[model samples]
Target chain A: MTPLISLLFALAGLASLALAMPRHAAQAKLGALWVARAPWLRGCGWAALGFSLLVRLARPDWRTGLIEWIGEAGLAAAIVVVVLMRRPQLLRGLPAVVLLMVPIAALLLR
Target chain B: MKTGFRQSMAWLHAWGGLIFGWLLFAMAATGTASVFKSEISDWMRPEVRMRTDPVDAVAAAIRYLSVAAPASSGWYMDAPDDRLAATIATYDVKDANGADEYRLAALDPVTGRPDAIRDTLGGEFFYRFHFELQLPYPWGRILASAAGMLMLVVLISGIATHRRIFADFFTMRPGKGKRSWLDAHNVLGVLALPFHLMISFTGVLTLITLTLPWAITANYGADTARAFADLDPGYYTRPRAGRPAPLGDLRAMLTDARARFGGDAIGRVTVENPNDAGAVLLVYRNDSNGVGYDGGVAAYDAVTGRLLSAYAEQRPAKSLYNLLYGLHMGRFAPSFSRWLYFLCGLALSATIATGLLLWTIGREKEGGLGNAFVARFTVGATGGLPLAMAGFFLANRILPVTLTGRQDAEVHVFFLVWGLATLFGLLRRPARAWIEIVALTACAWLALPLVSAVTVGLPYDIVGLGFDGVALALGGAFVAAIPPMLRKLRTVPKLRERRT
Candidate 1:
């Protein structure tokens, strides 16, 4: 399976996790409304991220798989940080709900 | 005498980062580009436009060597993969002085004919500059290693000093002068902390022997080469015999090695004593498939094409070292992973740049010649790098294709442009220098696509249109940055006048 979709899933997951944190979440007033649900959002975020890693690990070779996985994760983390800084609300519930489908689709493809 | 841990770390981070940050920025920027070294080389040499399986290319190279340097010691050929269309071959040949020297040739993989490619240092210059800074051996490497050590210290001290590392990862408040620069520095530093730490640590490890050879010297007592050979059997080099004989078909031997290794691709091939009685051929499997420096090496009698010895298994310790080395080099990375490395490298560069900017901004209120000098130097080095690189690409396109010593000329063009930028910085105000150099770099970037289209032909598969796309994108980014900068420049002067 291609790693692009998985990378997007990982980025979306990290964005959700970042937005759920009080510091980042408070940047957007909408984030404060869901601050109480941060724990649940974070858990879902980690699950999606773990699933994204699993997609990379499923490649034919372990060496490429491992390196690509870490690299993808790194890129995803940077993207999440940038997005949170610019528009934290994009990482809130609605977009997080939309992002959930990416990993689900990634899993089916795998 | 009773300084706190955070205070001590702050002192270390500030001073250490200031002293070595410029070199780190240069290394990061050039090293990021070096990740696409082969593609850049292909783009630089428009004459090399053929792509084929390396197996066929290897045959052509062997044939060329048999005729070109038949009486020489040996031959080595780096097989062309998808990225490169030409098989680069080197053979030992006697120069006009009758001294043994290596001659390199780029051959059309399909036709087995040598390509009259222009002499350009190509992307290898950037790769060399990344670590060696184009200085003399050992000294350049040693200086780079020292910078790496200083970088590691800065990173550790940065983490120690930053009390709210994770908490502040999301903080980036722009337009606060020194505060903004510090925010950017901290954010970029924290965002890619793992990547920064891994790269710096592995960079040190990659040259550990060179950095600290005392253990080897103490143990071996002046025979370090022999000691290394004993420790790592794979490092051994075979001596040529003083007898002449024709070499057997290398393709057939490679086929045998491939079959033995379950159809693995050959990464490198070395022909020892091409025309000698005691000749041998060494075939190494591509390391991309595994986290090892070399997958497996097999030795065959060059004349008879019979297997002599093979090293299919690696020691666990060596395997771990190879894996770390491979990670540091990223030679095993696929396209997407390579892009990720490039992006992380840019973040590292940005971190260094922002730290430099912060240093200047923090002292801007107490401005002096020293402050002004640092600011201008930072602007020159940071903005000048991209401009110089664009100038190098432009030089490659504009220079006479067949000019003698053209490769050295291209390097000279690079340094000359960079030196001019330094002078430009000294003469112009720091803000103006930043805007002007960036605008000039944008023009150079914008011209690349047009130049390539005129000279080489458009719709470049040279890096699968990557070179053109990146050129256009960089051009667009710089163009986008200029108008806002100009507006800022206009407003800043008025604000200063009002204050006066």
Candidate 2:
């Protein structure tokens, strides 16, 4: 579970880096490819990361839960940043999304 | 889109960077020094640097405290850790009229005896000054928060102004003039943007309530105490009971608390309602990962030492806050990560310095030293501050610990040295001032280890005293100072040549 969560986090980081790369022809093509396929890939990646975080949270040790939350938050923040950079207009409802997702995620995981 | 928003942002960035550049530079430099605070403290206090097994020594000290200060309400002991050598103990004593008094003593880890090495506060002074500047409560915090806000503005503006962030991401052409400095500053700032952003944001967030109290006042009603309690479950207050009770053994309670927290050592112990029946003991875990600034606190009944509650079992909101607080403090970071943080902190300081230099250069092109006062101020502040800091460390190493009013004298010497440096700068040429100040700083910093070794007879080796690491670090900083100092020196000659 930890490994899967780590992999998702790594993917999120890579995605952001790829998005942030220079807007040259090749880089733009790569970014566009990711943008085209990102919806499904990001959804799966977030889901896996969320699940692993939940698994870690359910453990008796509170430290493990806290560690998992950090991982989840980092992945979530990375995804939001990448998405916003790709499509700046997505920032309009970001605050509301954060407010909703954070409580909902906490409830579901807890 | 037609409003020239980018241009406005660039303007804001330039002005903001120019306005708070010096303060930000001081904060960054002090903050960088603070990252290695414990190590620096160890280097300064040579008497306590001797290696001794602390377990037995601490146990013996605890036994001694239990006897000597038995009538005292509560005793708190900070046992020697991996980074620190002296074990500090504080005792809360009740006077005849029922007034409370606190006494503190530092004990050698080896002999379990009082070690009155030096009265110098050591690196703690720099660490505190970085944020608080030793000013009274809210004022110091306000100043720090203002600096933090300026940093945020500078960062945002800097990013907006940079035409090509990635194109020059890895480009650094040293010794090229203002353009090179700008490139170096941009590269360092951009490469470590995430770290800088996170650190600054978290720093502001740490004091958000102070900065924006309306958020809590409006949301949580008038009970600020309750609001803070809700945010932090570890916080507890006990109603005083007039009757006194026999307090339990703190060492034993600490052992039990450590076991409960999954074998983590006790970092700090807090006793509430000391000398009363209602007194409760709270033991916190040390160096626990993910605990953030918040730690697991196990409350025990004062008399019987029965467990009341553990913070680890608190609500999710409170625990989450703790975790965030912990992450920002880097309490969980190992030795390697601490070094990384130190290096990043130094880079941040360099970034601020270079940013300030760029501003000065920009202004210089328009008017060459027209504002002599401003130039003198810059020379005094930039060069004199380092000399003052070096003097502080030197005083800590050389001053007699038992001298009457030595602590105050040491601090006075710091200010005096800094004052003299500034006066010298105003009287002399700015270029000459820079060279002289750098040379003095280099000499003072390089001589610190030798002073410590000679005075305390501690070997300068890494294994023996850990003083050499500090000496070498300080020496390296001095070495780095030479190129920049010489560059400033050469600037004067270049200007003269151009005029000729």
Candidate 3:
């Protein structure tokens, strides 16, 4: 459950980070909207990634968690790379969908 | 100054990468397979039948060892864990020349008999091949680490050469020939750069003593054993009392060891002088306990099950080394992390493959003999090797169970197929050869589970099923990759492509 949660966080983190770039934003067909939201998107992206790390490290073994966290983060970023190449137009809504997944995940965990 | 530095780094990255790319690709691919070695070993030994408690497995192993080599000096048993359903019993018995001859057999958890089991190296083959390249000692280690050092050099230079990592992190422009290859090399290198750095750096560190034994020589002069003893200080020895006595209870020793490790899993047990009065049982913690692999070692009196000496390395530098080594090995990783390690390893391999292809593609217009040689070899290294690995699996299922030197034969089949594939690559057009060989390998890999199911029954355990799953996944990936590859190749001039 935690892995899934953290992976979603990672997905959302990377998605927003990609969206923060005007080039990617324009490719997603939301240039003006992403241009206005760039700073917030960037902050959320870094913050989510950081939070995901913390969630991973919250396990009993920090070192194993840390390594797993790094690997999973890379995995999430790779998935984003694949998505960007395969269907660049989907980038407009992926971040929003993945971000909403976090709170829903929290509720499910509760 | 900056451009010059960048050019030098790029040159280093390209040339050095080519020199070691094949070896590194083999190592990385095999190492990824090695991550699930315990499961592979289990999958290979289908005759084992059942997954019982480790204690039950250990008892069966001990009985088998006692009957097989009662006069042996030592008995080493790798008891079954959750992943490996069978215990491996290895003993050292004296030969006619008074030299110790080591023998190993798998014990069935149900019957503890190895007579019905097939002789094979199982996953140990990949684990060893990665480090030894099947070469004899010292030479293999020296060459492997030399390759490893080159890998580290190339990886570092790759990072330096591609300084725009963030800017192009998500970019991969496929179907653009040289541009596509560079994009592949870049994105793969960037996303998993840290993993590649960690793996190669720690791989060098893992075999540092072999490559650079100056520290050991400086410390102990010529006695490396004494140096090892001093380094760990867990060394305990007792002279064998010539009086014959029964080997004591191992299950209790294991229970005690597990308790000592605070419920950590027990890895293996080594019993020295099992037939003598001064017998000793050493229980080591399983490598799966957390990240750093040292869960500590506890020595117990074989007769009385009394705990004697135990040690866990706590010295900062040694622990750091342990952490790095553990990370490199991934023995500490759970299922998810293990898959991550494997995925990252595959990326590392593909990064090398792309880098190799990029070089050949850049020089395609020249089309010299040297260019042709390098191009075909790259095809052989990237495409032929995986085909060879699938051949290893096919050979495992096809070879007669009773064949003498069957293990060596399986290895031979692997190399023979690899040799043939390389020859085929040399004969055919590079693009055609790549597609056909990869397609054939895909078929071979996809057929693995069916072959196993026919020879043995369908995989009964999760480990066996997992091996099958991965094999099918790899086959599917190969099949899926073909269309895109064909589409990409169609855009290029077929006549100008190298046919080495």
Candidate 4:
């Protein structure tokens, strides 16, 4: 359950980063909206990824946290890369879904 | 000498990656599978059901060994844990040549009797093949190390050459033939760059002594064993007493070890000279969950059941090495992390494979014997191996449980199937060979669940079902892939591509 949530967090983070890019953002449905929110989207991406690491670490201890962080980060990167290749338009909307998931995941985790 | 830095690096990357890509793919594929080795072993041997009372199984194994090989030099019991369903007891037995031969028995966790299951190599084959290549010991180790070094060089060179690597991170144009293959190669390599680098660098470190033994050789002269013993904190030996004596209760020692480790799982228990007055029991905590030089090894006077010393002291240098080695092995990873490792490994394998394909696709315009050979070889090796592994699984299910030399037969089937696939590749057209082999492999994979269901009934546990599930998914993927590939082949210019 934690892994799934953390993966969503990571996906959200990567999606924000992708949407912040001109090429992917230009292809997105809400290109102007993403462009207007580019800076915040980029920040949100990094913050989500960082929060993911924190959530992963919070599980038991630092050692396991570090390992899980690496694993979850890989999954996130893979998801981002695949999205970039196959469907750039999805990046704009993915962040919203990810943002929605984060609080729910945190609540469940708590 | 006049070539530019990027040009030189590109040359190095292309040649190095092409030369070692197949080996890297094989290692990555086998190593990925090896992540769930214990689970796969359990899935292979369906008879041994895991017991909740694993501690009781340790007691059971000790009892079995006491009567079985009391006079042996040592006894080691791999206690039944969450991953493993049976207690495995191995004891040193003197061979006819006066060399020590290890004998293994898989005992039922509850009854403590040997499980009457078909003997097979199980997951150990894949594990050993990853580093050893199923070759003679040092040669295989040396070859794997060399390949690791080449891979490290290739990775470094690849990054140095790809000036637009970051720019191309989001760039992928599929169905452009050579461009498509290159895009896939670049994307996979870039995305999993950290994983590839860590795995390669740590892989070389895992066999550092074999690759660069000069330091030890120079220090220890001809006695490298002495140096190893001095360096490794886990090394310990005590000579046997001439007088015979009955072994003490191991359950008491287990109780002491549990307390020592703060209730951490005990991975192994070793009883040295169990029937001698100098018998010593060594209990090692499973360090799969922690980064350490050695899991805590507690020594006990076997007859008296007295706790002597828990070997926890270690040099920082050795501890660092152990951490690197452990990270690469991923034996300590829980199921979720292990799946993550496996997934990354598959990506790495795909990265190498795409790189291999790109090499041939780039040379498609050249139209030469060498290019043709490379294409054919690529198809044979890449497509044939998975088919071979499927053959191994099929053999395991198909062969009679009690057939003589059944284990050896299963291994033979793997090689035979692989050989036949390679031959088929060599004889047929590259595109045709690939399609046939992949289709055949898919069929075999799809058959795995049904075969198991028919042969031994559906596996009751999740782990067993997981194997079947993965196989079916793989088969589905292959089936889904065929049409697009066939369509691509139809569109490509059909040059007279020779096999040789």
Which number leads on TM-score? 3
Off by over 4 Å in 3: A107-110, B1-3, B93-100, B238-243, B303-306, B488-500
Worst 10-residue stretch by lDDT in candidate 2 chain B? B460-469
The DockQ-based CAPRI class assigned to model 1 is medium
Whole-model alpha-carbon lDDT for candidate 4: 0.81
Q: Fraction of true contacts kept, per model?
A: 0.44, 0.03, 0.72, 0.50
Worst-scoring 10-residue span by lDDT in model 4 chain A: A25-34
lDDT value, candidate 3, whole model: 0.84
Q: How far is candidate 2 from the true structure (C-alpha RMSD, Å)?
A: 10.2
Candidate 3 lDDT, tens digit per residue, B104-172? 777887677887888878888899899999898889878889998999899888888987788887877
Per-model TM against the reference: 0.91, 0.74, 0.94, 0.92
- In model 4, pairs of residues that clash are none
lDDT tens digits, residues B1-500, model 2?
12587888777776787677666776777777776676676665666766554444455556666556665656676656667677666787776788886666666766656645665565666777777866899898888888888899889888988888866553455567778788768866875676678667777777778898997898888998888886666755677787877666655666787788787656666566665688887766665344454557788886677888888646666556656656556656555455556656666777877776666666764665554555555666666666787788778767777777565666787778877887887788766776777788878877776776777775755533445565557766776768877876778788889999
lDDT of 1 at A5: 65
Residue lDDT tens for model 4, B243-356: 998878878888888788788888888888888988888888876767543657788888889877777647778788878888898877877888888888888888988888
Q: Report the poorest 10 consecutive residues by lDDT, candidate 3 chain B.
A: B491-500
As for candidate 2, its clashing pairs are B292-B326, B293-B325, B293-B326
RMSD of 3: 2.8
Q: How well is each residue in B1-500 modelled by candidate 1, as lDDT tens digits?
A: 22999998888887898888778888888988888887887788778777776777888888877888887777877777767667767788998999998666666677766647776767778988989988988999999999999999999999999998867766777656567778878878887787899899888888888999988898898998787765566532566777777888888988887777688777778887778877888887776665567548888988888888877656787677877888888877778778878878888988998888888878877989988888888887777888889999988989988777787888898889988998888788987888999899999999998987887678546383898888888899889878867877888889899999
Candidate order, DockQ descending: 3, 4, 1, 2
